[model samples]
Target chain A: MIEQYLLHLFIIACVYAILAMSLNLAVGFTGLLNLGHVAFYAIGAYTSALLAVGLGVPFWGGMLAGGCMAALFGYLLSFPTVRLKGDYLVLGTLGFTIIVEAVLKNWASLTRGPLGIAGIPKPRLLGLSLSPLPAYALLALAAALLTYWLLSLVVASPFGRTLKAIRDDEVAAGALGKDTFRAKAKALALSAFLAGVAGALYAHYITFIDPSSFSITETILIFSMVLVGGTASLLGSVAGAALLVLLPEPLRFLPIPSDIVGGMRQAIYALLLVLVILKRPQGLLGEDTLRDAWARARRRRKGA
Target chain B: MDILPQLIMNGLIAGSVYALMAAGFSLMYGLQRFMNVAHGATYLVGAFAAYACARLAGMPLALSFAIAVLVATGLGVAINQLVYVPLQRQKEKDRALLLASFGVFLLVEAIILMVFGADVKSFGLPVRKGMDVLGAVVTPVQLVIILAAPLVFLGLWLFLYRTRTGTALRAAADNEAIARTMGVNVRAMTTLTTALGSALAGVAGILVALEQNLEHSMGLPAVLKGLTAAIIGGIGNVPAAILGGYLLGLAENLGIWYLPSGYKDAIAFVILILFLLVRPQGFFGTRRREEAGG
Candidate 1:
């Protein structure tokens, strides 16, 4: 039983790790605060879940479809919002989340509304279906590792440098002949695609999909993981995910009511977020070099 | 015509709450340039505190409300000192601060849930019967708020537009560095703005609880609506925020009445999106400055 629970925890952490990394790509690497990222996650989950359950598609195909759909939506959304900056972008993303949530809840014929979609089939590998515990844990771990590897590669590449350049100063990047809009669109699409993949994994693993699961609360949780782990850094996402996912399970063992336990878990995460921001707003693993560069850039702009 | 008048009355009552919520939200945005996602949590805290004082202390509803307001004011100050100040001094990423505010919001809500449980808690006071005015039927609390909201708006307007402290606040919000260079205490201004904004959120929460049932999640919708109102009115304009709140309230009530109830929350977002696309400057915002393009 304990081993089974550990596997469940591991899988959950892996899913969150994917989410954190995706957000880091947009916010940390591109410097765009897309608060409605969960909309993409929801799109992926619903897309994959519907394909698998309604159409009898294989899990792999469903996951791919989910990622593609999310990326497509991200690309579309970026056309309008990518032109805006800072708080405006934040508002745009937030609006996206609310609109998506409304659609999810209202489109009951497709989504089943608050009742949710359940009994999703497990992924079959080599013509064999493993127990959900091992199946989901392995899948999540693989995804997490792959996402981290991909993100690290992207962050280290010349394209990654350009993204960082855009993040630091879009005007400078534009002046340097880079297409600022295209760069932001690409980053947002990549981030949304990964988030959708994570959502697909979560849907199949949890064997349920509901509008409630993808609310602003989940967005906050993902944001906490990224902030705690340090935004824009690969290792930061993993560490933050692991800590946030596992911390609450042990707390659940205490002799508290379920509601209270849930509240305590939220509280612990919140306090951690506050403390982290108050002390090391850059993140635990984020280097000072990045911050100093930003400060210098701001100073330069002010002087200019 | 009767239905219209009744809807209009309902809108006015709802608008008062939105105005209260947005006033603080806009003020905080102006001063700190940070989105306090936790503003909703402060609203919940105020409601719960009021509920608790009324239930546990056996205080009169009015006194309990006053106590709630006081507690909420204290919470606002605490948030500013503990969260906003530290973050500003550190000069950390705004995203981090945003996440941190969300954390505080969740934490405070969780604490409320632990104390109050998941069930919706009420003041245990009897629901006041409605009064018929010409063609519209309105409850006493709703009537009070309808009257009080405009008064609050007027009072806030006078305070901000007519007072010395208000001038300082506006100066600091317009440009903190310039204000500091000019010998204005930017730190004090930020702290005061946060405190005042939070207090407004708390008061709004209490008023909302008086009209509706109190729940841990009430803050989420309240804050979201308040944000929508603020965005529509202009993020930094005091009078614009008040007008935005009423307009949003009317839009929401009318939307729910005419459209499917499920589309209620979506109404705000729809308006927000339309505004973002058509007029990002908002109702009262001045000319759009050059964006950073990042």
Candidate 2:
């Protein structure tokens, strides 16, 4: 029983790790403060769940479709708002999330409203279904590892360097002949794709998908995970995801009423977020990337 | 009565409250340059304080309102000092401030939920008879909202234009560094801005609670609507925010006349996106070439 609980915890941690890593790519690496990331996650979950349940598509195909759909949305959304600075872009993403939520809740014919879609079948690899806890955990772990590997490769590549450049000083990057707009769009798309995959995995594992799961609160949670882990650090993302996912488990073991447990968990996260941002904006494992970037930009401005 | 006129009246009533919220929000954002997500929590606390005063403490309505405003104003200043001041001192990025404010909002909301439970609370005031104006019926409370909103705007306008502190606030808004050089107490002005802004939010909260019902989650929607208005009118422009609020209210109400009423909330977001894409600086705001380079 203990092993099963630990495995369950591990699976959740892995899923959140994937989410945090993806969000870190846009927010931490590319400097896109996206607040509507959960919209893509919702799209991915709904797409994969609908395709598999509605059209009998297999898990892999459904997940791919979900990722592609979310990527498309990310790319499209980036076009109009790519020129917006800071808080305006954040508001734009926020508006997008609200619109997506509104559509999901109101478009009952398509999404079934708040009733949600249920009974998502687990994935099968080579006719061996991963239904058991251990197998599911392994699959989640594999997915997380693949995400980490691919993301690391992207970060190591010239494309990743360009993204960082754009993040640090868009004007300077542009002066150096880099297409900052295209780079930002690509980063957003990649981030959305990964978030979609995580969403798909979560849907299949839980065998349920709902609008409530993709609320702004979920986006904020993923964001906080990235911050806690340390921006621009892959290991930091993993550590943050693990710590946060495990942090609330002790609450469950406590004798407190279940009703207030959720609120307390949220309160804890809020406190942690405020303390971290105020005292250590670089995050626990972060290397002062954002501050360094800002300082560099200011220095460049002074020089010019 | 024609449904159109009634809807317009209803829209105006709602718009007034939204305008009040947007004015305060815009003032803070214009000067501080950070999106204070905790502003919504101030609204929630205001209503809760009013509820506590009138219902739990059995205070009179006027006294309760005064107490609620004071509570909200104090909370706003406290949040500024506790959460934002330290971050500003650290020279944290705008995104960090934004995220921290989000955290503050969540923390406040969680505390409210723990203390008040998830149940909806009403002001528990006696219902008044509906009065007709130009064939549209409105309750006395709503009429107060409609009448009071313009007065609030006038008051704000006068305060900003006629008062010494208001000039300091505006100077700070224009350029904080220059204002400081000019001997404006930037800290005091900011505190005053927060106090006034939060007081407006408190007024809006009480009015909204009296008109509808109070729930912990109402903050998000209130903030979102006020934000939409602020963005539409221009982020930092006070008068424009008021106009934007009315426009949003009218658009939502009129649009719902044709579409499903459930889509009313979505209208603000759609407008926000449209404004961001087509004309981000908004009607009253001048376009900055530097900002456009991003």
Candidate 3:
């Protein structure tokens, strides 16, 4: 039973690592800062859940379909808000996130509303069930490693250089004969795909999926993980995810009341985020620093 | 009972609240160009502060509300002094500011949960009867909400148009660099905007709490609606925010007549998406400014 508990914790960490890595690709590498990323995760989870439960699709197929569906949505969403900058872009993505939640909650026929889709079948591997503790843990670990490997490859590629250039300075990148908009849109799609796969893994591992599980609360937690690990670093994503998952464990032994425990946890994460952003804007592994950005803002102000 | 008139009345009352919230929220958006999501926390603080006064302390309703508004404004200024001002001193980027604001939101939410618990609370005031208004049943609290909203807006209008500080605030919002060149204290204006915005949000919280049940979770949704309305009217445009708020409230209420009532929130988001896609500048914002902002 103790081993099972540890494996469960490991599996949850692996899931968040995948999510954080994917978000890093967009935020740290591509500079989209798309707050609506969790909407894709929710879509992926719900899509996989529905496929397996309602249509009898296999796990691998449902997972791929979920990734593709989320990618499609992410790509489509980029076109309309491609011209919006900063706060406007954030607002656009936020609108999408809220709409996704509204659909998940109100469309009772498709999503089963707030009750969420249940009875998700566990994945089978090598003609064997993955429901056992060790098997599921191995599956989660493999998926996370595969995501890291592939995302690192993408980040190290020549196209990745173009993405960084755009993120650093879109006009300069455009002047360098790069199609920054298309690159950003593609990066968003890839990020969404990975996040969706993570969502699928979560759905299968937990064997239950709900709208509430993917709310902005989850997004903020994911954001904290990414920030703690430092943005734009694949290894950092894993470290951040694992660290945060374990961070709350010690609190369980404390004599705090049950009512304020959740609040305490949230406060911890929030405080960490605030400290990290204020003191280390680039994160634990990333390159951007608040001081440097401040200098740039000063220069721009003087120029203006 | 006439469904249309009743919906319209509901819409007007809700619009008033939304406008009040939007005006406060948009002030920061215009002047400082940061997503101060803690505005939601301020709204929560306003409602809960009133709860603390009226329900917990047994203060008279008018005094409780007055104190709530004051406490909320103080909370807003506190957030400014602690978070916004420091970030500005560092010349922080928009993303950093946004993240910090989210941090404030989370921190405040935790505090609220700790102090108030998760259970819902209210003033538990004596029940009042509804008055007939063009075939619509309107309660006194809601009527006061409807009336109070515009009076506050008028007050805000007067402050912006008739006051020198308001002109300086507008200048800073229009172009921070230019405002500075013209000898405007951009930091001071930003701080002032934060205070005004929080005050507006505080009033909105009190009015809405009087009409609806107060919960710790109430802040995010109310501020979100205010955000939608602000975006609809144009993020930085104050008067336009009022129009946007009314439009959202009306759209949300009347939309349930044709679509399922559960889709009311969806309708607001749909409008937001449409506005974002087609007219990113919104109703009052200039097209040129959108490109410039990008």
Candidate with best lDDT: 2
lDDT of 1 by residue, A282-304 (tens): 77777564777899999999999
As for lDDT, the candidate ahead, 1 or 2, is 2
Question: What are the per-residue Cα lDDT tens digits for candidate 3 across A176-236?
Answer: 9999889989998998998889889999989998889888878888878887888777787
Better of 1 and 3 by DockQ: 3
- Ranked candidates, highest TM-score first: 2, 3, 1
Candidate ranking (lDDT, best to worst): 2, 3, 1
Give the Å error, residue A125, model 1.
2.2
Per-candidate TM-score against the hidden true structure: 0.93, 0.95, 0.94
- Tens digit per residue, CA lDDT, model 1, B1-294: 558887777778888899888888899888877678788887888888887888888888889888887888788788777876666656545655676777788888888888889888776667878899757898887787788777767777787889989888899988888988988898888878877888788888888877788888888888888988988998777778878999998998888887878988899988987887777767888745753222
Per-candidate RMSD, Å:
4.3, 4.0, 4.2
lDDT per residue for candidate 2 within A1-304, as digits (tens), equals: 9999999999999999999999999988898888878999899999999999998999999999999999999999898767787878888898889889988988999999989999998999999999899999999999999999999999989999999998888889999999889999999999999988988999999999888999888888888999988888888899889988998789998897765787888888888888889877888889577678899999999999
> Which residue pairs collide in model 1, if any?
none
Candidate 1 interface RMSD (Å)? 2.2
The per-prediction tally of clashing pairs is 0, 0, 1
DockQ of each: 0.59, 0.68, 0.63
Stretches off by above 4 angstroms in model 3 are: A255-257, A288-304, B89-92, B175-184, B288-294
